[model samples]
Target: MAAITYKCPNCDGGLVFDPSSQKYHCEYCLSDFTQEELESLSQELVHRKAEHQEPGLREQERREQDRREQERREPGGAGAQPVLYTCPSCGAQIVTDETTAATFCYYCHNPVVLAGRLEGQFRPDYVIPFQIDRQKAEEIFSQWIGRKKYVPETFYNKKQIESMSGVYFPYWLYSCRVDGELDAQGTRLRTWDTAGMRYTETTVYDVKRQGTMEVDHVARNGLRKANRQLVDSVLPYRMNEKENFSMGYLSGFLAENRDMEKEQFVLDVQTEVRQFALQSLQDQAGSYSSMQVRKKEAGIRDEKWSYALLPVWTLTYNDKARGKIYYFALNGQTGKICGKLPVDRKKIIILFFSVFLPLFLLLMTGGYFLG
Candidate 1:
């Protein structure tokens, strides 16, 4: 596998994508380049890769064969073996799992994108680049943590805060059109007083509604091994801001290739779409005292599926004392946050007594004076 790293044209320093400036920056040279400048450089790198592709192909094939042999030798077929890539800058071995498309080199501390993992069908159709930079994300996290009074201090310490990572999580975006028809019965009641006597009348009517509805950009998590709750809580990404997929956008972040396919979510998405169509038709059934649906039908058409990568900042804290794990995720575009924080039981106990004890003593003293 080829581990590709973007290099600064002037100083040859490793280039990282900067979210705040929307440009690539070289740490050593303090120089920034726009995407246009990097496009030509990328093309040249492709040409160079093509010129020396034969040896890399042979090495990849040999590694695959060895992995297959190893799997066969193990009982019940062991899972996929870790893949190794040589870092372009420092020549250190970068070890990663099958789903890891981009990561950092531990020895050299430079970002590397595994180009082979994201080529061909594995490539994403769209990417929402990180808008909230690391500093902004850390500030947001701190503000959120500061609001919770009983949270443990260890969760937001400097060491733990430094562990936060910006990642591109894979998702499947679904869009479709629905043709729906609804049949229902509605009733209205009328009451009046005439000549000192009460009169009542009830009327029933049949209602029918038919319409076509368009639904777009329903996202579903596409990585199977990820935590579904953590990934899903930071939803509602602005689809309008998405840009065409480019490997350069992933330079300074961690990214994962999707193992799950769109087919896995088709049934669930279709059911949700149908329910929404039916409910919408019912809502238009007009004003009535009571309405009951007699028949409803919906047909989904023109289904569309898009593979995309969305940005998130994630942190994990393990509360070993309680044997529990807490997760924190922030939306990289909107700065929305979702987290599970460790509560300090001692603080809660103190707060409980501090407020109620004073009130209790005042009540007792007043009762004694009245007696």
Candidate 2:
């Protein structure tokens, strides 16, 4: 198999996959390809005999042909037509198929995100947009520290807080249908006395449950740095709000496509999907004292996928004293917060002396008086 490289249809320059638009785009010629065109072109090259050309040359041709075919079938591909934007400061380039309000520069991390970029290929089906902006995110972080008794004074002050940033993390959203079958043996204990003697008895019942669950959208983080639990705690995002992918929405945000492909997570995700489906079944089970799930099986059905951007605010802090890094995450959509905190050993010592000393002294005085 030859490696493929897409070239611009217009100018014959290199092309690459544009996640925001879900298309192959040419930076030089500014042309787009749909999924159909991309697929068809991809297929033709695979079977078609190549002339006596170098492997590199043949690979490049296949890539360009694939991009054109992709644009034909993919709705988010070039056919919808997006406007491209370039940043003068960092030379970061972006394109949006629809109108967007803001855009950011991927190269220099500029936040000049335009307001109109959310309507097109950059648009998110649903946005857990930046409800906790940088400033507010700092405040929330400081408050989180304040809750910790005996935290170092340095940890609470504005100097440290100012270093915090609200970063928008990228993630993938998946939708699937789930069917679950679970079997277990439930045990009920009974006690009875034979005459005056005590007797214990137990009864076991075979339990079985089968159900269907429709999972609308399950999200998995695309960035390696994004903490899975912290990101998940902020759920559930309003998945219903997701719009088709448009490049415009990406204009102003720090966005990334899934670093890990969709198939990589299917097994891990199956558990969550089954849990959701089983919740309904357990509710239906009603009045069981305790249910033990024994044998269980889940099958994902009617699976369909779309790439989307969810929202999160992440901050990383280095603790010099502890020689470790601490992270804080906030749910961009729900404002829920979860993260690790630095514990000060000095403060713990102070707390112990303050509380335990007085208690010990009082105990000693009472003993002396009583004696």
Candidate 3:
């Protein structure tokens, strides 16, 4: 309903969260405040407004709250339409899609969000801020493409490169401890030669192994609509560095709400933990030519899942003729990269014919002439 800006208490300037400093920065006054300090200050503002405002103003605010809640719960609450606002820093008009919770201003480059977009299911419990910046990401991309020369000239066009945006992906991070047991029949083969006679003997043993193992930081993407495989490929953020959720970390980046809940990933998390525990005990099963595992149980005693935002650099490009969209992902913290790259059908065909044609001709001539 209104443009809300995080204001600096000292200078009343628009405050932006800086990634390097992990603090809120005032663009106009250059004041810096710890994230906790600014949060406390925000709480103070809300309390002062409620206490000092007139009764008529309070009534209006209450009515507005009711109206907003009704719109969200009613049919076709809010969809498709992007929120429009002017940047408090440079007065640039900005528009963001409905699902977008956080993004940067194009003109002034300040991060903006419709505070409503980050409530309830859309809110993140923790966030891993971007450690890799644009220049380093570009260098990584360049190194990746420099080795492959035939990956369509249009892939690296200025527009597609510029579209490489830092995005916070929603993930369900799980930690669990499983007490597991494994049962299997293990076999050992023995061979002996004596007096020109060969003899073979097989020894079999029933093995039972049990142990407790803990798995931490098992991640699954929470957005059903996004490419799950692509998201999984980027994997493995440094979960140890995760910090409490705050809008300051999301500044100057693109972010979205989690479309799926922790419930969706529960089975997957349990399954992974089970497999890990089984393998852990299986490693202690001694030596065998082959062992077929029979019963394996994780007995997953405990599990915890938290909604987290992991950072990634996302580059998406389309092959219009092939009608396919390709993605390149760079780990925002570690700079590890992965993606699908298009293959040139023409080059493959040429190489195939070059290697196979001469051999086919030689075989044909040898068959006819030698016959």
Please report the candidate that would top TM-score against the real structure: 1
Which sections of candidate 1 miss by over 4 Å? 52-79, 192-198
lDDT of 3 by residue, 199-266 (tens): 99999999999887777878888776678777778887777888998766666678876656688778
TM per prediction: 0.90, 0.59, 0.79
* Deviation from truth (RMSD, Å), model 3: 4.8
- Candidate 2 lDDT: 0.60
lDDT of 2 by residue, 214-239 (tens): 77777877555456777676777776
Q: Any residue pairs clashing in model 3, and if so which?
A: none
- Residue 67 of model 2, lDDT score: 62
Compose the digit string of candidate 1's lDDT tens values, residues 1-371: 46799999999888889999999999998999998899899999889967877987878866875664455346456435687789999999998876788999999889999887776667899999999999999999998998999988889999999999999999999999999999889999899999999998999999999999999889999988898889899998999999989888999999998878899999999999999999988888888888888999999999999999999999999999999999999999988888988998888889879988888998999999999
Off by more than 4 A, model 2: 1-87, 90-127, 180-210, 246-253, 275-283, 288-298
Model 1 local distance difference test score: 0.89
What's the lDDT for all of these models?
0.89, 0.60, 0.77
